[model samples]
Target: MTETHVPEKLKAPVLGAVITVSDRCSRGEAEDRSGPLALARLAEFGVEVAHPVVVPDDIDYIRSALQEALDAGARVIVTTGGTGITPRDNTPEATEPFIALSLDGLAQQIRLAGLAATPLATLSRGLVGVSARGDRGALIVNAPGSTGGVEDALAIIGPLIGHILGQLSGRTHEVESADE
Candidate 1:
């Protein structure tokens, strides 16, 4: 068999934003743990997180926040909360119009990982997608609102960050083995 080699593309370090969607949190009635949790997790990967925001669980509000983050040069927007099976949960619906592609596998993996910790994970309506904005072309992903859910989702996505960035920058290569 012939060996195949692919060059890796260089991508600039991109900015990110963490948006926590909860009515109480937006109203300053409850602490916003999910947003902070997401920021900390992303920081571990050396990603710069811009200002995080707490918004009510409203579709229009979430949509506006996403647009603002993208306009502010955030290449990745991770939203926590409003991804449940409730009447007020409208994250997926709000984000649908902004996505260029839906990353079902990522969301599925998150759900599966969350399931290991709680059966309620099956009810999570988290989603992942690429934003439709022409300039930013960012990847927008929605994860569960709880701290544990945020942790699990990031754990699942952590290993793929480099590859995703490579892909976004128009490079494809076989990831080097850990033993190497």
Candidate 2:
């Protein structure tokens, strides 16, 4: 597979993880597409992706996977699936406790992008945030369950991820916008 060259000049050591949340997928009743897609996208940006994991819609299981990934030195954990309004859609709720700071702008930006494509985007309920797990920090982003939704979210997220990683790692060379 060809890796997509990042636009930024410097490639920092960005570690990442992808979690797919789906009952059927986890039970081997259905194939997991979102997880692999997210992992591939992270790889394109030169991130060292930890072993991908898939869990059911259970909140406790989701939280466990998240904590394990963060403890393993993953700076970015993107979760796909379970961000909708269905009875089992509880990813956003499950993720709330881990987030030290909410990255509302990212969630909104991704939703708006998805909204342009389909009205279902408004109901995705995907959440994004920063988690200060002990001395380290990680950016946790929630993506929709569909393969296309994950692809659309990645199109907007991929470019900005480098900056987020730089901020998390305290990179002094970071270039901020004039307004900031």
Candidate 3:
């Protein structure tokens, strides 16, 4: 079979994971549609994604899922769900502790792009940030539970993953001055 061409400039197969945070899905009362969708989307960007995981909306459960991904060497972890304004939405709260640096622009871009489709996008409290591990850190982001939100986020993240990863690994195209 012919290989699917990735639209991004990823230098390597990025190790990534997808977490679906939903109380119903975790309890098997609902199917995890978003997690699979997220994995497929990341694959389209040439990301080497791990098996999708599902967790409840509880902060501890969400954090455990994220921690597991990080421990497994995932360089990027995109969480689906738990970003709305509802009380059960806890992905952002769980994720904040891991963020050493916030990528506010990227997060804002997701919301802005989403606004073109629906005003409710403004209600999504998703965030993008990198861990404190510096060169060994991972880019963690929370995408709204809906498939459209995941698509919107990937649209912004896909093209930039290479550069973001590069920056995290201390790779840059900037030329140094001789004065240094």
Candidate 4:
């Protein structure tokens, strides 16, 4: 596996979470592949998965999972599922309240990257943002529920993950050493 090389300025490795948001998956009615798939991809990007949560499509459940991940000091949190137009699709809504700043480009890039494969990619309502709830808030991003979607999203995000998290934590600049 070719590991992603995070910039030198980023000294700390990413401690991350993957939250699977689907009512069926949450209830054991459907097999979840996206969450686990995303976690594996993240490993190649040098993000250490610290939490993996499965929550229903309900807004509260999604928010609770995000909150728990943040409390655990996750620097990056990626959620899959519930990003559609259906009545049960509430992941974006669930995420908005917790976000202090929006990273619209992250979601847009995912959609744009997938557009070549499927025009329906525009229908996803996923979001990306930062939550300043802790001392070093987490960078939160959402991806489509399908395994393919997770693959595409991760491929696009892998190169940018370190940069975004470094910015979120104000650590993009390399710290000077005593002799350097």
Candidate 5:
């Protein structure tokens, strides 16, 4: 018998949440551009934004917000800010417990690409992982605080979103041409 190869296409509806982890933003003292930027970027991919929130940088606060978004049915959660080396940056620590699988390669790629523009990008200690809490699954990634950094991360992951969603939904067909 000969083995046949088949291509896969994503059918599951993709929902997203954007969390801006900044104390001032949560307090309404600062405007949130990162969360909105994430929402806009994901919108181009046809992913619906389910919950967009601004939370304090406290570890527990960020963790609770993430849990809330996940519970609200967000299949992808993109977080900005609080991933640096500063004392107040606790997004990474807060998200550690909820992670099911860490995608180090994706995180590394983001870092590598960002490094070309600014050395400060190397200071980011952001992470990417999957959540084990839901039946639909969620991919959680920490994007840099800067607008350019966010753009770089989005560009790097944009093409992969559909493929990732397809795998998560168990679809098996080619949805777009390689030229896309």
Candidate 6:
């Protein structure tokens, strides 16, 4: 597998978490493929990923999972599933309340990249943003449930994790200088 390069400025491995939002998976009637894929992808970028959690496609459950990840010290949390147009697709809505700064460009980039693979990507309502709760907030992103969707989202964010985290921890100047 082709691995995304971890930026040199990243002095340490970043902590990450993955949440799979699918009723069937949560009910144990179906396997959760997206969550594992997300975890592996995050690990490929040198992220220390926490064990993934599976949740039903409910806003409350999704929100709780987000809080759980945050409480567990996850610096980046990726929720795979519930990003489609279906009635159960509530990842974006669940994640919105936690966002202190919206990363519209990153969200758009994921969609734009996905469009190259499938036109249905346009229907995805995934979101990307930062949840500024403590001295350092976690970066939260909502990705579709499909394996392809998870790949697309990770491919876009993998290389930028360090820089984004740096910005979150008030190291914007240092991160910027490294880019120069």
- Identify the candidate with maximal TM-score: 3
- Tens-digit lDDT track for model 4 on 1-180? 334454542455678899999989888999888998989988888889954689999998899999988888888889999988999999999999988988798789899877878988899989888887344877788899988788878887777777776676565455455565
TM-score per candidate, chains pooled: 0.87, 0.86, 0.89, 0.85, 0.84, 0.89
lDDT per residue for candidate 5 within 62-179, as digits (tens), equals 8998998889888788889998998899989998887888888998999999989988888888888788533577888899877777787788776677766665566555445555
Candidate 3 Cα errors over 4 Å, as ranges: 1-8, 175-180
Which candidate number has the best lDDT? 3
Write the number of the candidate with greater lDDT, choosing between 3 and 6. 3
Residue 91 C-alpha lDDT in model 5:
87
Regions of candidate 5 where Cα sits further than 4 Å from its true position: 1-13, 133-135, 170-180
Worst 10 residues of 3 by lDDT: 1-10
Q: Positional deviation of 80 in candidate 4, in angstroms? A: 0.3
Better of 3 and 5 by lDDT: 3
Query: Residue 102 deviation, candidate 2, in Å?
Result: 0.9
lDDT of each: 0.83, 0.84, 0.88, 0.83, 0.80, 0.87
Residue lDDT tens for model 3, 73-153: 888899999999899999999999988899999999999989999999999999999985456789998999998999999
Q: Candidate 6 residues 19-98, lDDT tens each?
A: 99999999999989988999998887778886789999999999999998888888989999999988889999999998
Higher-scoring candidate on lDDT, 1 or 2: 2
Candidate 4: the clashing residue pairs are: none
Worst 10 residues of 6 by lDDT: 171-180
Deviation in angstroms for 55 in model 4?
0.9
RMSD of each: 4.1, 5.6, 6.1, 5.7, 5.0, 4.7
The 10-residue segment of model 2 with minimum total lDDT is 1-10
In candidate 6, stretches whose alpha carbon ends up further than 4 angstroms from where it belongs are 1-9, 133-135, 173-180
Colliding pairs, model 1? none
Cα lDDT, model 3, residue 92 = 99
lDDT over C-alpha atoms for residue 174 of model 6: 26
